[model samples]
Target: MNLVESEYQMGKSKIFMRESQKQKLDTQLHQTILSRIIVIQRWYRTIHQRRHFLNFRAMVVKIQAKHTAMSI
Candidate 1:
């Protein structure tokens, strides 16, 4: 059997998961894997969005602090 490895990067970090296949996958198994993949994708998106939002909020706070200092 042929074996292969792949890499996927999320944000600035790297993650790896090994997957093996020696024969055809049944529908139930395939469905389970697909659902898990979907869930992981959603989770990653949520994390990335939160990071962006926090960065934006921090920038706003910084700007407000600077403005207040200038006024004083």
Candidate 2:
């Protein structure tokens, strides 16, 4: 941490940074949270789509089975 003397202050038990540093930290935290949310959303969409495809395939199979039984 490059603490310029003017950019920070050291009190008896606390260290304070300038507004610019605080803003930079806030931006980084928000970006990290948003990236994690994107990953979770992508994973959930993949699982939901796969389940929907499986259901559709099962319905098609059932329809084919009924058609074959009627022919027999």
Candidate 3:
């Protein structure tokens, strides 16, 4: 009976340790994913800004061209 009790305790300890390790791993994974999302969002914002700038520049050029034609 004593040996059986000791074995059970050891098994329980192992299970607890495994669960703790898994929780830590999950937390780390969540943080890494969050960081990646932030980086992607920043990159997307930069691309959007660049596109907007290009569109604004194009409009300015078109407006200038129209003015020149009117002057001629």
Best by TM-score: 2
What lDDT tens digits, residue by residue, belong to model 1 across residues 1-72? 233434322355654434333222344578889999999999999999999999999999999999999999
The candidate maximizing lDDT is: 2
Report the C-alpha lDDT of model 2 over 1-72, residue by residue, as the tens digit.
Answer: 444678778899997989987776788889999999999999999999999999999999999999999999
Model 2 Cα shift for residue 33 (angstroms): 0.6
TM-scores, in order shown?
0.62, 0.75, 0.67
Ranking, lDDT, top scorer first:
2, 3, 1
Instruction: Quote model 2's TM-score.
Output: 0.75
Ordering by TM-score: 2, 3, 1
42-71: candidate 3 lDDT, tens digit per residue? 999999999999999999999999999999
Each prediction's whole-model lDDT (CA): 0.71, 0.89, 0.76
Judge candidate 2 at residue 70 and give its lDDT: 100
Model 3 per-residue lDDT at 53:
100
Clashes of each: 0, 0, 0
Tell me how far the alpha carbon of residue 9 in candidate 2 is from the true structure, in angstroms, after superposition. Answer: 6.7
